[model samples]
Target: MSPKEENNIRVLVTGGDGQLGKCIKVLEKDYPTLNLSFTSSKDLDITNKKNIAEFFKNNSLDYVINCAAYTNVEQAEKEPDKAYLVNAEGVKKLAEICKKYDATLIHISTDYVFDGYKNTPYIEEDVPNPINEYGKSKLKGEQYIQDILGEHFIIRTSWLYSQFGKNFYKTILQKSTTEEKLTITTSETGTPTNANDLAKFIINIIKSASSKYGIYNYSNLGESTWYSFAYEIVRISDKLDTRNLEKADNYFTLAERPTYSVLNKEKTLKTFPTSIENWKNSLSKLQNKMYDE
Candidate 1:
């Protein structure tokens, strides 16, 4: 067989230090055709038009995987402006630059765009009715990207976590070790996506060179409550001292989350053919990684 043709697909990963970005970095070696450039918010502030222009002038990119987001749901309630600045306006700026540079954008979004009133899984065509600041900001970003560019993929995912960042997985692991008992809310429910899995999917799409550009939903195959997620983490860690409880309080959090926001992944699976693992199975793999560490 002849040597595989190098497409030399140049990709720019914003939020390079974030969980998903780190996962992409881990898998970079597997895709020899991809040449990736990672830039954190400090390196490339998406909100500042001048900064984005300057950076684009210096470097050329074929694709941009945008992971930078104002993700603090509760904090977003207090700092809505900051959230909009980063999540909405920043995304608009990035989309504009991508248009100017003729670059495709693969932007990360959230399942919180739904109001949780629907009993079934959310699809790509679902009308978004965001009830919180964070969700609204994210929806605005998605809108901007769609309006600005056609060569863009807006992937809406749920409950992304990894060992690399401050996510629910790391939080539960740390709490299980310190606290004697953990009381987590069961009212909210969503799929717990391993960032590594999502990262692999992104790279697979790039490698395929598919032009199936539009919004898609991706997450682990199953859904669970935060309480159940915590329990599994504690169990996998072999923490006998930790006790986990599922509780539902009216005012458990400053921000409201969807009681159920499982994303439908039919389009992504059909388009990319990436193997997706169940949430529990993915968690076990994460546990093995923790063990190795």
Candidate 2:
């Protein structure tokens, strides 16, 4: 994007401290020509309807990328109300305010919306059959945006990790050095997406988002299980404990996962070329990037 076009951004990323949100913050340096703004969950609480409405009324925003959500999966089973409060009702406030202010809403969602039963890559049109509280809550958020706003993009991503924030990559890397035998679920499968890639894609779409306003699936182009992801972490980070490296030990998770939640890229590919990074390719590189800081 050109300097003038970039300046037209007037973009705001909610949940700016999150993995995806922090990634977007870093990308701002590349788009320095753009007039950008960021608000973490601390800066703006989406659950408060009035805070959102007042902010939109005051700012001249061109786009609102909402990365905020109550994202604890297994935790959501017990705190359904908390999940719905932020993921569902909180997003509703975003969509509603963005509509009133004439800014497009680019909302982040998840692949967990599908019940992991589809034998192939999930498409935008697949019937949503969320089996868990997290998925259902995110889907409810999407539904609010779709029903309330005329111009919106709901990007569904899965197995996401990044260097700047707490993620599966950091968790696995930390645990690998502590546990005698790590047990991760092998049957559950999904694509892992790098946060930087997601940020770049959003910036691209926002520059000319009139055409990219719709539901799209964006992630790294392959699939793997939590077990394999953990195994790869051990391979790259030699700091991993020696006790667990002799044999591969894994198990099922308490929360039922989408055995096949890989997302199709036909929609996003129509715009920016889809990322070619495999699940492991991105994971291996992220450890170095995270360790650098």
Candidate 3:
């Protein structure tokens, strides 16, 4: 075999139907040295150990990017057991399998792990004090990966959106067309991340084969409230006036979210050395891409 063929990396993306997974799929063609496989929960249920084991037995994997997660914060409050089953227990099983197979695991985490009590952006070293069930479950999953595996990259991101799946970006765009007035909350503060950029970052790590095994914070550079995000979305789509997007001080939610949960990307930038885009610019790019598609 040629040297390039010999050095090809094998990667499996779980929850392949998710926004992040689909975003990664869009970049699959760009990385010729990486052999990619995408599997939805129906195809490879991480919650089932035997199923994972059997699949691992058949396929030799170099890395596993786990995108499968129970992400509905409000629903997580009602079904803590289900959240833990997928986020914690399921992750533990996947980590164990990766360890057994000697494959590095790149697990996607959430900014919700932090309580959002701090005035500034959160760093990887900050103590995680989750305020809700979803955050708690995701934190537990991060713990499992840390304890069970030696080679792992735990990336914590916030407010992720993309062209492929249902997200706030799409919600705003849809609402702009139909709703005469939209009132969004300004109570919470966080960065809106473009999943396409995140997908590139993950692929870069794999391509570089960096052994910096630890947690990293990644998101767009700046922060914004839900109201600001919606405003920008409508403005970008040229429907702001028609939508009558208004800012509200409070919004009702079943789950308690961190008032502020922006992440510090200094560590990720210094480590990986990549250009991180501002949230507004990234949002515009995504909006343009959506229209083009």
Which candidate wins on lDDT?
3
- Give the Cα error of residue 1 in candidate 3, in Å: 17
Candidate 1's C-alpha runs over 4 A off are 1-6, 240-246, 249-251, 290-293
Best by TM-score: 3
User: Using Cα atoms with residue i matched to residue i, what is each candidate's TM-score against the true structure?
Assistant: 0.95, 0.91, 0.96
Displacement of residue 25 (Cα, Å) in model 1 is: 0.7
Candidate 2 per-residue lDDT, tens place, 185-252, comes to 67778887887778888887776645556799988888877776767778887677534743333454
Residues 32-126, model 1: lDDT tens digits: 88989999999999999999988888887888999998999999999999999999999999999989988889999999999999989999999
Instruction: Please report how far candidate 2 places residue 14 from its true position, in Å.
Output: 0.4
lDDT of 3 by residue, 1-293 (tens): 11223357889999999999998898887788789999999999999999999999998899999999999999999999999999999999999999999889999999999999999999999999999999999999999999999999999999999887899988888877888889899999999999999999999888877889999999998999999998888887754563488788989999999999999999999899588999999989887774223
C-alpha RMSD values across all candidates: 3.1, 3.0, 2.2
Candidate 3, superposed: residue stretches over 4 Å from native? 1-6, 240-243, 290-293
What's the true lDDT of residue 271 in model 3? Answer: 91
